[model samples]
Target chain A: MMQIVKPDFEFKKVYETLYPVIFRVAYRVTGDRALAEDLSHEAFIKYYERRNPLPDLKQTKYWLIRVVKNIALNYEKKKLREKKAYDKLQFKYPHFTQSGEAEFIKEETKSFVQKALNKLPYNLRIVLVLKEYAGLNYKEIGSILGIREGNVKIRVFRARERLGKIIDSDAI
Target chain B: MCPDNETLSAYFDNEIPSPWNKRIADHIAECASCQKRLRQFETIKNYLHEDREPSFESSLEQLEIRLAGLKPRTERVSLWKRRVAVPLPAAVIAAICIMILGISLIFSLTRSNLRTMSIRRGPSGTTEVQVAAPIEDLELLLKSLDTYYLKQEIIITLPEDSLFNITGEAMMFREAEFSRKRE
Candidate 1:
């Protein structure tokens, strides 16, 4: 008899295995702990509901990271659509600014950083997030993103250059 | 002379080739602007490394409970299909077949002589006995048997010498019982 394995068995095991990595990835992208937790939960639920096959832990982590990135991007787009000022950098660095003008300047600086991070296309964002957020090395990121290590290095370099320009412009 | 961005990035990443690595170090030492840029990259690295880990502790219990509550649909279906439905099905089928066959044989013997015959003239005006056994629609017959009384016999009676297709005979009795059960 050909037996059909219940998808939930695989789902539970996969969630247990990849949850931490997914949570961390979401946190890095969204820059909010609670939202990251929720996003990771939602991602797992969505993956489970799709009857996704249980991949090896590494692949699952990569998939989870990708899902979190797409979701966070959509969220940012939605904020932009809503025309909320804080939406530009909704998760700002909590370090306080003393003067009102200084606070506005800091806010603008953060906004510039957010906009730059958002502008770097999915290709660069994936590499940058893998390197800076998930802390994956070039080889690991190359495998996850299906690119050469050299390509990964170049992409990260370009991303950092763009980010530096954005921050430097705001400082001026 | 200062190194380019790519070389500087590689130098910062600690992946530069030996001679180029030494060259970038020499440039950083000689050039204040390049040194400041190197410090900036170092700051970026520190900020990245200083990222706080997110906590999922509050949601863990709920997530676990939900996951636990999610009984795989195949498992439930399989449990019923295998544990309950499989073991005694053959026996049930056997019992049903036997009961149907016995009742059909008894009924057939009682009504065997009541079959009607008909004759029709063709173009040649020939006469023939068209002996036709009236075949009851089993489904319809079973549907109408609600009015009839059933003895509910413990032991089924069978003829001493029976020769016929047992399947058809069993079907007849099964139909009759099904009809009676509707009442």
Candidate 2:
């Protein structure tokens, strides 16, 4: 693993190639395009700063995936807290648009699959997205999440099974 | 013998090792329970990897904007770590700070080049660096030191009424000698 400490390192090519893949994993995990974009941008920024520490180009990409997943997880927690505060606000100060519950129900119908995916626990959801969308193997995902390869396999399987059950239950 | 659920799932991804991989393949071929589980795994993997990630054009645009505007690696990371909105306010503040610091560094480095420095010896004979910089440079240094200010109080007593005694004696002398001369 030769050190790549070049003053003119070409990071643009890597960014272009990796953005789509990282974005998909983040989007799949969080189920929001805007949030995913933020998460993806954050991961790339982190990679830009820490690219030298990684041993090689391949490790750098893996490091990007790992950082993206962790950032997404942290983003999810922060978003959850914001949502709780928002719900409390809504309860205290009841403001409703003419959009109404019926319109909300209609909108929910359109994103049923997404809602189901969001329902899956974050740990399972993260492993599933990284494996399926990020296209990382068990060892790679394990290295990212700091878990065992066997555990990664089991989580991925459980995530898929739970997703299938949810989809079947909803018949969407 | 039946493999564990994790091992069976690993087979779908072909994560099983050498001898175990062959054994699982042979076992799944003959065993109905493992075969059923394998089918379930396949069904789920197919559904879970469904291509549902929404497309956003903003990804590349945002990246381009950042790459175009990147000033320096250290400053970029510091600004970004504090906030991800990528606002220019922090960058502006950071640039101002760096400019100030650079000027200070240059000032210190060029200290030896100054033709004259008025050194004031304090009570202990230690010299104080009252820098004789250009007015603009001095103002800049003063502005940078705006935060730390010290306050003090002092009292001064004025000599009062000692002149009254002298004035009284002079009047007495005038009344005695000068009055007689005038008369």
**TM-score for predicted model 2 compared with the true structure:** 0.60
Residue-level lDDT of model 2, residues A1-172, one tens digit each, is: 2233332455776777778888887777877777788888888777666634455657877888878777888888897897787778778878934446874774464365677788899999888878777778899989999999878988977887788788888884
Name the DockQ score for candidate 1: 0.17
Model 2: lDDT to the true structure: 0.69
Pairs that collide in candidate 2 are none
lDDT of 1 by residue, A16-105 (tens): 777877776776566555667778877876666543354487677777776777788787677567545444444473453336596466
- The DockQ of predicted model 2 stands at 0.15
| Residue B167 in model 2: lDDT | 24
lDDT by candidate, in order shown: 0.63, 0.69
Give the top-scoring candidate (DockQ). Answer: 1
lDDT of each residue in B54-129, candidate 2, tens digit only: 7756786887687666543432233334543456999899889999878877765665422222433333545345
Candidate 1: tens digits of C-alpha lDDT, residues B1-183: 777776687678876878879878987888998888788887666645554453666666567766556645332233345543455889889899999888987886775532333433333445443434332344452233333413321222222343333444554456457667866
